[model samples]
Structures are given as structure tokens and as C-alpha cells.
Target: MKKTFQYVDYLWDEAKAAELGDDQVALFLYRSNILGADLRITNYGGGNTSCKTIEKDPLTNEEVEVMWVKGSGGDIGTLTRKGIAGLYTERLRNLKNVYGGLEDEDRMVGLFNHCIYDLDSKAPSIDTPLHGLLPFKHIDHLHPDALIAVAAAKDSEQVTKEIWGDTMGWVPWQRPGFDLGLQLEKCLNENPGIRGIVLGSHGLFTWGDTSYECYVNSLEVIEMASEYIEKKIKENGEVFGGQKIEALPAEERKEKAAELMPLLRGLASSENQMIGHFTDSDTVLQYINSNDLERLAPMGTSCPDHFLRTKIQPLILTLDPSDEVIDTEATLKKLEPSFEQYREEYLQYYENHKHANSPAMRDPNPVIIIYPGVGMFSFAKNKQTTRVASEFYVNAINVMRGAEAISEYTSLPRQEAFDIEYWLLEEAKLQRMPAEKPLSRKVAIVTGAAGGIGKAIADKLVAEGANVVLTDISQENLEEALATYKRDEAAIALCDVTKEESIEKAYKEANLAFGGVDIVVHSAGLAISKSLPDTTLKDWELLQNVLVKGQFLMAQKGVEIMRKQGLGGDIVNIASKNGLVSGPNNVGYGTAKAAQQHMTRLLAAELGGDHIRVNTVNPDGVIVGSKIWEGDWAEGRAKAHGIKVEDLPAHYAKRNLLNEIILPEDIANGVFACVGILEKSTGNTINVDGGMANAFVR
Candidate 1:
């Protein structure tokens, strides 16, 4: 509720705005950033801003008034001019006349398209009409947590009058569309002196002649609501104190989350369709552990805006409060009946509310799941949607807490929620999303992902729309690699593949992250170059453990999870060309890799019945960006070849028929091609050695 606006920053933004040819667009971006930077004001992609401005048309060569509203697909925090859609006001106003007799969203969308001022501008937000109908020059609409707390209260109108006095107007719940926009306009006209309006069971709206004035109006209103909620909490302290809530210790929570997340994910998934889970944050725990969770959690979302993201009601797991440890087997047994009951209730709710022309019902699977001893698990078709739903639900819990502290929380009636959920405008948002990539909805795990070829493979998988869990012995390196991706789908697990417990934990993390593993890249290995006579027993054993034993454990763990889910999977092992053809002074490393190559074929034979494919990539002399080929190992290999360390790469490349140096990415490309693109060819070795005549698999 604290105001974040600074006069100096505002002045600086204004000074920079004059330099951009489109001042209105620049100012809109600036104000939107200020609003988005504060989560208490608005969450990711949850709010919008607009400005009415004059621009010269390219064809007409005359100035026309336009409403530049936030576009549909981008976040406001980093909004650019391209993120705002430009619509000709004169043409947009004409929609009111035609739209009165229309209820079809597709036709309304066509009408909206016809009013665009610029053909290349992005699609305007669905709420564009609400902004266009208002007469103000600047407008801001947001779903602030504090304001939502007030809006969802049972006596919201009374609270609005008390906190906002005559400056605010209240409108009852109406699905966002042509009619709703008209209703908002009517409210403003009737209350000529009101500074803003509260959309009951929805959000807040404020406007002024300038962007700063509108921004200030939003802050002041939200602060007022916060103060009211705080006062209520103080007065009703005794009433709130009666609720019994207990939190598990941090270590216990972590242990329980690992066991429960995978079971929840597997239960939520079906053939060719999977849902992932994330339990890293404390927000979910704080809400799920509350004693009042059962009474308040079943109440619908804080606003209709969240219906498309989070379904009407979250699925609550039945767990005994006193049980300190989660028995995964027993929990799954109990969940079977509860899941069936939840599905029945969900379908009945849909049948009770469906109209003749309603769109097809979405899957009945739960979007949010509450785990008693651990935390909450959010499930979605992919990683990004899962994260977004998690964020919204967390904010909803905060709003619920505030509302309950003052009065009982209330959302729109169930029928109204159904209407919003089926509204064509809302449904279009999902239908218009870009087509999925080839590996979309797939999950991959890459061992030795801290650097070199393993890191490159992880990057390639993510680019193809696969959620990846990068595992390595070095936690620091894993974190640094994870930071570069900037995606919620990419996670890191510090794992030593030689240890059974470590390998199991990594796969569990992957399951929790992306439901189940479909692709496994066994790229963790160590290179120890030494002559057969000089290699001691300890050195040879170390190489064998890391390369041969480590790969076996990693592959076994991945296959077990895949088999449980009953989904066909892919496993690609990274082996060296020396495994096929012996090279001087490469005894320990070469022998271990040879064992790994044979093991790949054996595993392939065993798992083929389950439709699981196993393959290997033999990459030779891949020196560039390879951490394994650094320091003493590189110098020793070069010395054995009678060449300087700097000249070793050229020496190896010149010996190959293609006469090209192999890089880490070349190996990564081979791995991806073997497991991802080649789908039919398994138990085969793909040689990525720049045409090594002797190392060929024949």
C-alpha cells in the first residue's frame, strides 16, 4: 500500500519522453512501468494503462485522436511503444451502435480489428472498449491486492463508502464485454465528481487528465483500503486468534515436498497430456498451512479476471493435521477417491451452468492443489502457465486473508463465474496463443549441465519448448548457468550422479518441475589421460565410476519414472570417439567410455518393449569450450602427441577427413539429433567427429 512514485523519476521520464517522436506512447510506457514495478499495485500482466493522444495518419496526412491501450501479450514492467495498440477513437466509438445488438465475441473481435489506427500495431487488450468509452485523457486499471480485499468483502459497498466517500463509484459484477463497458461509462456519467470507480468482485479504475494524476489516485485509494483492513484486524484480533495453524520445519517441508510433488504431478497427467508442479516458494505454504484454509479456500478467485488462469475452485488434499511425515503410497491411495469426487463435482457444475452455445468445457483437472503438511502445488500444461497461476493464487490468498480479517470474503456468484469462464473474449486469449514448438510439453534432464556440451544440450532443449532440469556436481556453476536462461521452465539441481541417493533426488526434482521426464542426456563424465602403465588402480576406478557407473544410475532412475507414467522416453549418452578407436595415452577415459557405449545398447534392448529409446553420441576431440580438456589434461595429451597445447586442436582437426575442429555445440547438436529429431533410430551411435574415417560406427 506504500506509494512508490518519486517526483524526480517522474520528471526524468517526462524529459526523456520529449525525445521520442511518439510522446504519448513513451509516457504510457513510463506510467505502466511505475505501476508494474510494485506488486502490491499490480501483478505480472494483471493491469493495464492508456492515454488518448493525437497522431498524424500516414495516408490522410491529418491528425486523428487515438486511444493507445496496453496490448494483449506483453508485461507492463518492460513495456515498449510496440506493446501499446493504437486504435482510431472515431471508428471505435461507432462500435457502441453496432455492438448493442450483438453478443458474439468473434464478430466483436472483427469490429475491434477494423478500428485499428495502425495495421501493424499489436492486438489491443480485451478491455480496450472500457478505456475508449471513458472521456478521461489518461486511465489506469489494476487488480491491487488491498483493493481486491475490499472489493471481495461481503459488505463491499459499505466499505467503499466509508473509505472512499463520494470520490468512488461502485459497479456490480458484469462480464467484460460491450455491455460491461457501457455500464462503466454510465456509472462515470452519473457520478460526475467521483475520482475513480470500483468494479465489485473485480478490480479498481482511476483516471485523470495526466498520467501522474491517475497514478496518484490509484496509490491513495489503495492506501486507504489498506488502512481500513489494518484497523479491522486490530479490532478483531481475538476473533482471528481462534484459528489453529501449524507450519512444518524447513527441512521437514523440503523432504515432504519431494515425496508429494511427483505423486501430485503423476495423478494430474494423462496420456499425451502432462501437468507440472512447483513448490519452491513460501507463499503457498503460508496459505495452505492456515487453519481457516478449508473454509476460505473453496471460495472462488478474488476476481473474474483470474478464471482463465486458475479454475473456479482449487483441489484440496485430504491430510491429517497431526501427521508429521507424508506417506507417499498411502496419500496416493487416498487421493484416488478424492480425485474422482472432484471430477464429478466439476462436471456437474459445468452441466448446471452450460448454455446452448457455450464453448467446449476445458479439462476438469485441477489447476491448483493444496498439500497439508508441505505446501501448494500448481499444475498447468506447461511451465509458464503453471508459474503464472501460482502467482495469482498466492495473491488471491493474501486478499482473502485481508478480507477475512475485516469481514467474510465474497466473489461473484457461481453462475457469473461460469459466464466469465466461457466468455469468448477470454477464450480467444488461449486460442490465439502461438503454436507450440516441436518439443512443447516435453521434459528433459541434462547431467553435467554446469558447462560444456551438457549446458549446450540443455539450452537447445529449452529453445525447442522443453522444460529442462540441469544437474551438476557444482551448485555454483549450475546456478550461474540457470541465471542465463531467464525462464521459469529451466531449473537446477546439484547432483553427484555416482551416488544413488543423489541421482534419485535429482530425478524427483525433475518430476516436481515438469511432471515426468521424457528425455535424458547422460553427459556427465571425467577425462583422465594417462598411459596404460602409468594409470594407477585408483585413477582407473575413479574414471569408471564417473563415466560408466554414473551413467547407469542416471539412466535407470529416469527410465523408472518414465515407466511409472507409462510414457515412451528418449535417452542419449555422450561418449568419446576413443571408445571405438584407441588413442595413445588414453587408457582410463577411453576404457570407461567404451563400457558406457556397450551399456547403452544393453539398456536399449531391455527398455524397447516400453517404447523407450536409448542411443549414444560419439564426439571426438571436442576441445573448444570444454572444461574437461583444460589445465593439466590438455597439456599432457598435447605432449603425448608431440605438439604444443595451442596446436593440439588443429592437429586433431587436420587428421579428420572434413578437417574441421569439433566444438561443444557440435556434440550437443549430435545429441539433440539422436534423441529429439531421429525418433525412430535407437541403439545406434551417431559419430560427430567431422568425418573421422577410423572412428566411424560401421
Candidate 2:
């Protein structure tokens, strides 16, 4: 079902109690709607918006209303009192002008002091001052389908100019929030009185004195562009119907699928497109199943936003729209040049619009959907962007329904879209977070850390400046893990990971050790020793209890602590190597690992909406006289292989191409990477397998 999007008037009604003079409240409400729209209009939080307001002290007769902007995670549709905070506009503007920019912490404190309600909430939006600099009262930001359709096309700027005239000013896509806002401020100062802003390869933004005015401006810009594209499409929709044919058998189908995937993958710079994010979706099945495949082939991708999503075009299954034959090889050959031309044009566009010293180029196979007979498929960097682009294409198709409509839709020019897609300023936005001074003060809980990978991860995390709580099922092993770390830097807790009561107590103890728990890594898991044929129900249940059930309980408790602290947190799950790429000999262990991996992904998707990052790591092998791999079991396994127990680690390491034995430290580093202590890779997984497997399964 389509999610509802609110208008500026709806926001106006919500803030009626605040009165016009309560501009701070008004500003907060407005900012909330912008965030809401960003969330509702797309999948995930693909877009963001903000507002600025002044704050005053009722007492002292002194005041600086400043700019009360939306706090991070403050969704527009449901923004509340604490979601918006006060920021000093003059301070921000001054900082931007300084030789070196102000730190995120200082800027956060500047805004934090201005919050009217809770001080515990995250700092104001990174784009606080960017909104402050806008001359308009209301701003509307979105990755509009109509606009993206034009933005990523071959002559998008020309199309944009023809459609909007001098009324709109276009900016290359920059990472949104602060950096985009700063760049926008620069643009506004240069352009003077431009009515709206078009971010090539990104989205559209329009503003006015009121929400209605801004909304109308946004609609007008999109409507004009859509109308122009519609006219151009009418001139060439049915130029060719092409030729037609018949269907193939099941074995032939699988063979054809294998053949087409490689070609499509070859079109991509990496193995990403063929094994892209959408291979598992129903849409992929539908595209591949379509009988009249070539009917959709000649048309361009739905829109520019889709370039990163559905790709430049879907792979046509046959030469004629009515053909039922799934001639995958023939279809790929016919579509080859269009793909090559698309890449060339994309690069040229980037070069034309970019400065000499810009960041390196991104891949050019923006979108590559597959069609098996009549079925279709698509993918993108994130789930949300992919959905929006897909829907936009469907919408554009419907708009031209039955009107001699074939290839009516056009994407923004490749060069213009390329410029926006590869814009360095935008890339920088991904790294532009408010300085996390308080994050350093936060504490984390890593479960199952009695030894092995858990202990290694905890040590690495502490060294980078975070108080850590190491927990395990064994009291002696827990103490052993504690001994490996500095007493002042870490604490140890004993708890059976399989029990909720034990996890709850561990959370309480960890919370008491530090002021609050800000990060949780559930690494304790049991691996079944038997093969699937030898595995019993009890063994399966035990693995599920320790790996799957324990993770759930720990995550539940971790969220409660994070929520109470009013500061979001991170949760990392240590899944096994079998989870992502295989159905190994241990049935129970493999099943549990797979479930845990997916659970981590689902958690990240849900919790990310709350500004919390949820992710997982899949460690291949790290056996070093550890409890899980020690004693009789290790010795017996070693004897079976005709090697001493002490030689097992070396033997396993030699099996991998890198011949690098993965230490618990490597696993620990993977966890930190997920927590973004290293970089911002959320809802992802890293395999510490030393190059064991390189297939694209997940």
C-alpha cells in the first residue's frame, strides 16, 4: 500500500496551538513535516528537510531564538517537542566563514542548549544552518520521480531548462543535510532570487513563505517537467513494434538465466548488477518471466533517480514485445551498445560538469533490471531508493498508457546525472557527521566474550575510547576475557546467553558499570558438532537457543537501555560463515546462523529509523586454544586429520588463499566497522574469511 504524505496545511493545523508568534513551535512543526515527507515519499529516509526559528528566555529579558531545527531521527510526520532544537544561526554562519570549520560537538552544543524540552535527545539536524540561510519560510525536499526521470537522461539540463525556464536553479546532487545546505546557500547567494532548486541525480527542493506555497512550487516544477516529457514521448512512442516468437522449457530457462546473468554482470563494473540487491525479489521473477520482453527494451529507464535503482534499463527477453522465447543470449547482444553508450555519456557528463580535482568516478551501470520471459527486476544502493525509482517508472508507464506509448519515458541527461552522482561535495556529506564527543563517553556490552573473537573485538573497541562490558556464559572464561583487558577500561559479567532473565541481569550490571549502555554486540553462539544426518532435535534446539534466541533477548534489552538514555545506539551480531553463503554440514548451527544474520539486517532497517545502527559480522575461522575449539573435541578432530591439536589453526589458515589466520582481533575490527567506529557501513556484513568464498549469494 502507498504511504500517506501530508501537506503544509496539515502541518499548520498540527501547530495551531503554538500560535504564529511561537515561531519556534511553528518552525518545529514545519521541520517535522519535511522529515515526514522525506520518510513517507520514499523507502527508508532517502531525503531530509529542515527549518530555522528563534528562541527566547521568558525570564532575563535576554534571548537568542536562534534556529530550532529538526533533530536527527525526528521524522517529519511525527515530530514532537524534543525533535526540534535551537541552534545559533549567527554562530553557524560564522563557523562556515572561519578558516577551519567548527567541530560537530561545538555545533551540537550550540543547538542542544536551544532545545525547549529534553536535553537527552540527539543534536539538531546537521543542516540546521543551511535551512537558516534560506530566504523562504518553508522548504520541501524529495527525490521526485518526475524530476529524477529527467535528471539522469542524456539531455537532462537542457530538458530542465526547457521545462522550468529561469524559474528554477539546478545544483548537482550533494549529500543532503549540512553540506548540501551549505552548497545551497552558496547557490542562492549567487543566483539571487531563484524560486526552486533541482539537485541533479538526487531530488528536488522548493520553498515559499508558507507550507502550501512551497508545496505548490514543488508540484509546479514537477508537473511542468512531466508535461514536457509527455509531449516528447508522444512524438515517438510506436515507431517500432519489432518482431515476435515462442517459449522455452524449464532446463532451458535455467540455462538462459545463467547465460543472461553473466552478460548483465559484465555490463556492471563489479558483480553487483547481476547479483545486485534485487535477485531475491518477486519483481525479478516477473521481469524474467515476461513474454513480450522487447516491448519494454527500447524505452529509457523510468527516471534519473532510478539510475542508481532499476538501472539504465531492464534486460529485454526477446526482439518483439509479443515474443515468448526467453532467448537470453540474443537479448543481451541486442542491448549491448545501449549499455555502452549509456556509460560513455555518463562519464562525459561528469567530466563536463566537474572540477578537475573532484573525487573519482562511480560505476556507470546505474540500474540493470532482469526480465525472464515477462517477469522484471531492479535494485539500488538502499532499499528505499530502489522502491521509489521502481514506482516512478510504473507511474510514468501508466501516464502514457495506450497512447502509442513505447519508450516515452526519458531519464535526466547522463552527464548531468553523472555530475550529481559523482559530486565530491555530496560524497563528503556521507562523512559529515556532527562530532561525537559524547559517543566517546558511551559504554558498550559485548556478549559471549569469554574468549575467541568476542574478547578480541572488546579490546579493540576499548582502545578506540569506549568503556566495554564483556559477558559470557562461563564465569571463569569471562574472568579470563577480562584479564586480557585493562581493569579500568573494561568490566566482565557472567550470564547464560540463552536465557532472558540472565540477559536482563547482564544489562543491568553493565548499565551500572558505565552510566548507560550505548552499544551491544551479541557474539555468543553455539555450533552443533554433528552433520545434518547425525543432528538431533535437541542439538537443533540448543543451537537456536544460544544463537537465535539469545540474540533476540539481548537486542530487546539493549534497545530499552538505549531508548532510556534517549541517545540511540548500535547492535552488532557475530553470525557464522555458514550463514551468508552456505548450507554447511551442521544443520542446526547453519539454520541458526542464517536466521541471526537476517534478524540483524531486519533490526538495522527498523532501528535505523530511530538513528540506531544494527549490523552483523560473519567470521570464517579463528581457533586458538579457545574453549569452543579446545580439549577432546579439538584433539579428536586433529587426530582424524592426522595433525596435532596445536596445528589446527595453522592448517585452517593455509586453506584460505591469503593464508592469513583470522584472529579474534579481525572479528573485533569487523564489529567496530559495523558500529561505524571505523566508517559508516550500516545494515551490512564483512566476511573475515581470508578470501575463502567470493560468490554473490546475499
Candidate 3:
């Protein structure tokens, strides 16, 4: 008989499974992908899945039981065969004799090396023994919100029996270790014929004789729990004790979030700079707008992963967005002390629960901040980490809603949460992470980023580990250009530099996407080759708006953000050699270029006290991949030189000392040199025009 689900999708495709030809490991990978595809089932990089299969040993040439499980830090949704570690089940089980007790369970992690059946396997996880020691051929340990909702209920043990009856067993809260594996084994032995079990204040475990059966069982249990929770919630007829305050108007909400993100990011990054993510997502708004936000947020997250990513508790601000007008100054004043108190409390938390072997307390700042009328902001070391941290908190909110509707919600015990946070194994894992890149924790904003020089600069910045906001006047161009970069380290926002509102929207997007900009590159401009007589006021004004005024506005906004963040920044202007070596028919265009270069010097002089650097990169003839040269400008320039438009590149190259052509990539290199390499030099020009003597600045 086929089964249908209301809460979770029935994603098991038998025909697709048939394509695998019954290799247990291949089947395990397929099932793992399906389960992980839904956040309702498991969060990113959370949970564990394994299959114990009969395989032939290379040495013995005989059958042996081998366990293949998800390696540490692997996301099952994107897991490949290489991401799963293989171990000999007999070796895992043999460790039981040497295992001292719960106190010595962490040592077994080191012993996992001797059990390696696949020498090329990925690093093993703490849950390896939980899978290997179980009698079932296939096992799934998932953090489904519906199951966690029940597991995190105040009366979870009684609630588990009532919801699942005698079929699903229950074990009280215990950290993942060899000891918990034994407890699970004991539960299954005590209750014969049960299909699964729920770990209190944790997650769920369901197993089957076959991979397909295990997948189906997991779905059945989760969907059934969802249905029951929905019914009880309907009976209760209220959520989060009803809404405490109305959500601000949608547009107002975004503006409010934009205003708050940079300030909060500045406060949170006192110990180490951070990248931030903002969400007024339906789930987040629903939770924060409720009366229970203050009550429940302090209870902390139920899932260990959520708690670890979002921290033990979130910092909830008293700002009410529904007020007719908000006092920004008052909020700023409150934030200073709120941050101080949060750090002190976090330190106290560590001091209270830490053991002698615990690693030093990490950054005591809050990872999540909640505002009543606005939304949530989560900060971390990079863009992806911030995004994933926010998603984990959303999952926690879902668990809270479900648990509270049916019964009182429960968080992990304080000592247990602290133990998991300060675990020696976790410290080792953190120590194993690769060193950060030169531009790590920095965010850059690139105007004219759709194509040409702007895109090149954005790409280089991202390569050096900076998060980027790709801003351009054309939306269609921005989307097409952004798609090519193909990484989460970059974002796109449509912007018209001539307009202050457009520029504000771009900065808002940048602030929300990856905290605020630390580097600003002004690459958005156009060129015209009209002679002095041919240049009309309209032509003159167009150049000024895009070239001169655009930089003015962009710089104005960048300074505001950088000042608020209190982090020194960089502003690189992509000027032209025309600014220096003025010639025929260049009156309007050359004046604007000169203004741009001078503006760089003025800003550098003014901003130097704040440690902000301003520099310029001058390129004379960047014709290839150059949109500016594709039109009347190229025709006009070629006409002046008495050469065909096609000959412009060589014509300009011959004029330079190096006799070399300049590309957008050369301009991009200059920008990197200013921000990444020439750290001490500012108010200076780096000419990238193949050594143009006439354009050189002493």
C-alpha cells in the first residue's frame, strides 16, 4: 500500500532507487538526500544517517559487516559518496571492552581510526557508534521539528507514550557519545517490536531492515506527530499566547531592519568582525511579534545545533516598531548596555558550567538579535554561516510553536547545553578549520557590477574572501551578471547612482546581506567624445550625473555606513587618463574625470582620521569587453584619431610606453592592490594604462 503525507513530502522515488541496483551504500545515499532535502526533516549539516551492510574484506576475502555514516560537518542534502566514512562494525563493537565509562567516552572518537574499513573515508562523527552498535541494518537519526517539538515538551516522556503509544521508546537527555549508544540499545532491548525511539530534548531515531523501510518509517512518524500537533493547536485556539504587538507595515519593516542591521552588526563584532543576515520571514515575524517571545527566547533553543549556531539565548530588543515614530538615539543608547550585559551573562554562563578541560570561552557576543516590530538579525564569520545560523533559529521557532501549542516547551538543561558548547571534541573541530582569507569578514560594494570593470573587481574581491554586493543601474544586467559569479559570497542589488533613493536601497541591501561595506569601488560611469563645440548642456550634465555626482552620492552613503559600523574602510575610484592628459573634444568628459580624481584626494584627506582610505585607478584604453567603447564614443574617438573603430585598441596601445592594451582585469588588479596590497598608501593614483607618460601623476 502507498502512503501519503500532509506535513512532509513523500520524496522516496522507487524507480530512482531501482537505478542503484541494490548496493546498500548507494541506497543509503539516495535515502539520505531525500530526507535532507526538507528542512522540516533536518537542518543544514545537522543529523546523522548510516547503513550497516555486509561487505567483503580486502584482506580476508570474506563477508564482514561495515558501517557507512555521514562524516562530521557534512550536509546530507549535498552529501556524496566521498562524504560518508566507512568503518568495520566488529571493530566498533569491540571498543566496548576498552570503553571505561561516560567520563571516558570522548576517547572512543580517537579509537575510530582503528575501525576504518575505507582508508580514504572522510572524518567520522560522534554518532558513528550509535549507528554501528544498533542491531538494525539501516538507521536514521533525524532532527525533524515535529519530533523535536514532542521531545522538547516539558512532559516529553509521558507525551511520547501518549502520541506514539508503546511503539516508540524514550530516553532522557544525554550528549551524543558511546554511553548514549548503549542507552539506546538498552531501550530497544527492553521494548521488543518497536520501530523507533525519541531522545528527550534531542531528536528522533527510526530504523528498518531495508533503506526504503527506514525512510518510510521516518516519514510516517513525523507526519503523524504533525497531524496530532495541529489538532491540539486547533483545540487550544491561540498561538504564543496570542500576538503581543502588531507587525509593522511591510515597507516600514524593511526600512526598520535596514536601519538596525549595521548598528547591531557593529555591536556584535566587538570581539571579531562579523557578516550579518536579516529576515522578517513569516516564521520569525510570527514568533517575535507574539507575547511569548520574551518568555520563550530566554528558554533558549531545544536542538543543540540550533543552540550552538544561534548561541544559548538570543538578545531581544525592546524596540516596538508599531509606534508612529521611533527614537533612534534611544535605541542606540540601550544597545550599548544591552551588549555589555549579554557578554557579561555569557561569560558568567561559561564560568558557572565550565570544567577544567573546557576550551576558553569564545566570543561572548550574541549571535541572534530580535526586535519586536522589525525581525531577526544573525551574525557570523561569513555570509553562508550567517544565513545558515538564521535558518537554524527559524527551525527552533517552529519547534517552539508546535511544542507550546500541545504542551509547555522545554529547552536543554543548562549544564547539558554548556557541556555540548564547551566539549573538547568541538574545540578540536574548531581548531581544525582553515585559516581565514585576507579579505575574510569584510564586505565590499561594487557599483557598475553588471559587466566590464565592475564585475571584474567584484570577482577578485570574492576570490580573496570578501562578501560582495553587486550593484548596477540595470536590473536585468545585474541578475545575468550575478548568475555567472555563482557563489553565496556575492549578492546583487539594482542601483541608479544618480538617485539617492536607489543608492540608499543598494546600501540597505548590502548592510542586510553581509553586515556593512568595508570596501567601496566606484566603477559606474559612461563616456562621450563630443568636441567642445558639439557638447550641449544636456551632454555635459549627463556626464556629471553619472561620473561626478554618482561618485559623490556613492561616497556619501559609504561614509555613513562605515561611520556607523566604526570600521575603517576603502573607497577606490576607477578614473580615466583623460582626467590628466586633456585633449581636443574632451572639455566636458575630461572635466568630469578631473573632478573624480580630485574628489578621491579630498575624501582621502578628510576620511584619513577615521582610517578610511581613498584611492584611484586610471585606465586609458580599456576597449575589450568595454560597453562604453561599443557605441558613438568609440566612433567619435576613432574619427578624431583618423582610424577605424576596430583599430582603436592598437591606436591607443601604441601611444603608451609599454605598447600594451589594457583590459578590465587590469583595472580590477589595481583596485585589489589598493585595498589588499597597498595598505599604507592612500590619496594616490595607480595607473593601469600600460605606462602612459602623459597621464602619469608625480
What is the per-residue lDDT of model 1 for residues 1-698, given as tens digits with 9 covering 90 to 100?
23454311222254565665456667777888878877777777887889999889887999999998888866777777878888998888788777744355457666788889977778987788888898888899888888888888888888899888998999887666666678889999899989889988788899878766776777777777888887887888733234356667766666666556556666666423565766646656666766777877777786865756788889988866345324555666787787778778888889999888788877887888887656777878788888778778877876887788768888678888888888766677879988988778788999999999899889888887888899999999999999989667699888998899999989878866776688999998778888989899998989888899999998888887776555688999999898998889988888999999999999999999988999999998888888888777888789888999999889989989999999988888887787668988889999999898888888
The better-scoring model by TM-score among 1 and 2 is 1
Residues 1-698 of candidate 2: C-alpha lDDT, one tens digit per residue: 11222321222343553455555455546544543553223323334454544446455456654554556544455566566655555665555553133324234434434433334444555455556667566666655545665654545566667777777777774434445666787878777778877775556777766544555566566666656656765675432232132235544443343333333433542323222222323333333344333565445443333443444445443333343224544655675676677677656756777767667766666454544443233333322334445554453333223122323334445455554455454456545744533235557788877777777778777876677889987888777777777544687888888888888778756643443466899888656555567788888888899999999999997886565444567888998777755543556777888899899889878887666788878877678634567554465456546788779888879877889887788887788777746345567777777876642235
lDDT (10s digit) by residue, model 3, range 1-698: 34788999889887999999879999999999999999999998989999988899999999999999999889888889999999999999999999999989788999998999999899999988888878898899999999999999998899888888999999998899998899998999999999899998899999998999999999999988899889989999988988988888888888877777777888899999999998998889889999898899999998888887889999988655753323545666877898999999999999999999889999999999898878889999988888889999999998999999878999988899999999999889889889999889999999999998899899899888999999997889988988886556789999999999999999999987787889999999899998988999999999999999999999999988887777788999999999999788788899999999999999999999888999999988999987888788999899888999999999988988999999998898899999999889889999999998788798
**Candidate 2, residue 518: lDDT:** 68
The candidate that achieves the highest lDDT relative to the unseen native structure: 3
lDDT of 3: 0.90
**What value does the lDDT take at residue 14 in candidate 3?**
79
**Cα-based TM-score, every candidate:** 0.91, 0.40, 0.97
**True-structure RMSD for candidate 2:** 17.6
Candidate closest to the true structure, highest TM-score: 3
The alpha-carbon deviation from the true structure for residue 375 of candidate 3, after best TM-score superposition, in angstroms, is 1.1
Q: Is 2 or 3 the stronger prediction by TM-score?
A: 3
- Candidate 1, after superposition: displacement of residue 311 in Å? 1.0
Residue 258, model 1, lDDT: 59
